[model samples]
Target: MSQDYSSRGSVSRIDASISVPVRTFIFSSLLWLLVASVLSLIVALKLQVPSFLGECPWFTYGRIETLQRNAFIYGWASNALFALNLWIMSSLARFELKSSWLPVLGGIVWNLTLTYGLIQVLLGQLNGFALLEMPKEVAPAMVVAFLFAALWPAVAFARRPTGNVFVSQWYIIGATFVFPVITVVAQLMLLWCPTLGVMQALVHSWFYQNLILLWLGGSALSAVYYFVAKESGRTISAYYLATVGFWTLFLFASWTGPATLLGGPIPVWLQSVGVVAALLMLVPTVITAVNIFGTLAPRNGIAQAWNNTTLRFVLVGAISFTLSALLNIVFSTRSLNALVRFTPFGQAQEHLAIYSFVSMVIFGAAYYILPRLTGSFWPSAKLVHLHFWSCAAGSLLFVVAGLTQGWAAHGRTDFAVSALPGLLAASLLLVGHFAFALNALGMLAADKAPSNRRSY
Candidate 1:
């Protein structure tokens, strides 16, 4: 057993050796996140006052919305996921990352492509689909860049020292493999070949759902499993159930696309299948919640768990995920769907899942991982607290106000007044983003002196 452990020195080397690439990814991600936040603020303000940015054609709602989504998903989320998953894969596989230069080059290319794509979007060259709005010219470059970026992690997983794989490894590997395939397929069908009229909508919907569930959600869950287990100092509870949850998510989640088109021209059977899939999502959600919540529950006492910042963020994210799942199930129902389908409810649900849940989990993982990667402690606990509260408060305000807007807009045509509060609430999130940016920059700039740091 000791020999088995000794053979894993490469994994330790990974932690010590990959600091430069990891910091590059993280720093780039935060910079993009700040950019996304500014775009989001603009969009929110535009919602309240349509004329706010109407003077410039590039700043029109449609173009800004597309740019905002691209920046958030590709710029912020994808970059952060690359850094986190690279570390997670190396840690789990007990191997050092090979060909590290590939990811660094890939990171540069990815950011450049995203910058070009957003510029094109602002210039009105959008593909006109929800998430696929990035110009098709950049798609091939993105695919190549992603392949390069993901190569090291893929190699590390393949060369894992042990047959035993952790739950986090499963999620990280699954997402890593799945994202590129779906992305290429979506690009071909929707952008390259151009699916027939209504089929285009279907294809776009399918891709969007798959991207959210299989990619973003998978990576976030990986972080959740890893951080929760590490911080709690416990192996996952009901381990087999986690496997079941993973498989269920992969199998059923993609079929949920048609539910988004309940009132559209899609076939009844397809919508029925989507609704069924949405409802079936409860299986994985419940299983995941049970396993994670059980492991996070008090062992000796609750104080340790309560005091842990990572655990607190993960727990809140888990709860948000579970609630989002329940709300998806509820809103997919025919009666409820009819009421909220055309309103801000869907946006509320999206913000809850992506911003509140996935982003929170990533933030927690950053809090834990950054210190180790940077060889320094976070500069200020106060900033961390400020970030947490601001995010929580802002999310609560946005969701509540969005729900209120949706309720008020249920049967009405003019709902601008109803959306005012949500717009105001969304502006508060800028404060949280600023707090995070300041904290991150301070940590990066602070001396890496051992004397100034607490032991991780």
Candidate 2:
């Protein structure tokens, strides 16, 4: 692994052939992430102040919280992956964005629809659940718009030079072509299907899980596989293991969400299947993580060569995967759920999975990929360091706060369906959530500045 990377470092840098749909998607995606991060910051503040925005209908916690999470999940992460995927596909295929305007249009439509959906959520015109907040009509509309935009990438991939297909490219290409199609179909059915009953919850979970895994996780993992291996100059020692893991993740994880609702009013079998899938995820998640970590294990040259933002964030992300897998199993257990299910402990568990592992890895990948996409180096190394440090420390603080207070509030019998107990939990959650939002904002601000700018 180290040897492969060292050689690449010594090789000359290559300028992008040109911007195309791929780069277009990536840059647009990051821009949406900025907007989403800002919204997240607002939501976090609302959690603390409750009336931070003077009781505007759209600015309330219910409204803002829904928007904040959606923005990050759909707006930020999906698009970030989209952007990175487009750029890599373009390079692999040796094609410019076939129609640059397509990605632009897709970006416009995506942001417009997402903004409208957020407004609907804020207006209290939509359901108020975690990833299911977007109304049916709007969700489908966004999907159609993205499909129209994604066509260019499909065409480019088809047209790209045929060569020894890198394992990463295979997944990336498959995800790029099929992802929007899946999202569109699922959402349209969700909107029109009266069959969506308690199964509505099932469908909802399926959509959310697939969106993250197929849409975001697929691309992000592919990029990490490509970059980590390529940058390290190591062809994955166990490429077959990596591929098998991918299939395992996709198959088993598709049925995994109902497990989160186990012991709730969903079908027993739904929960049963989901529970099995959730537990099984450990196999692939660990396998993939090991493959990446092993490749980067020899720090002899990586520290100096792949040393900057790209590798550092990747390492943090890689380590976080193990934590997420273990936590997923722990939280999914029925024995542990009695006290933690509705408590901040659940919140702690999810945050570390998304923010610590998934988001951070993508962040690291962006530190590397975005510079190539944007035709400029990161604005500030010191700022990047600040972003990494404050976020890592604050998240540690937040997760600890969530678990400790969750244990306190939930463990005690005094916690019942009253506003006071709710307030206690809410307040503790607020502190940790605020810390998270502040650090994310700092990172966003730093990304826009020059790499040599004044430290945060």
The candidate scoring highest on TM-score is 1
For candidate 2, write residues 422-446 as lDDT tens digits.
3343344334334433433344444
Number of the top lDDT candidate: 1
Which residue segments of model 1 deviate by more than 4 Å?
1-12, 300-303, 411-414, 447-456
Query: Stretches of candidate 2 above 4 Å error?
Result: 1-31, 49-54, 151-153, 299-306, 411-456
TM-scores of the candidates in the order shown: 0.93, 0.81
RMSD for each of the candidates: 3.8, 6.3
lDDT of each: 0.81, 0.63
State in Å the error of residue 349, model 2.
2.5
The CA lDDT at 420 in model 1 is 75
TM-score for candidate 2: 0.81
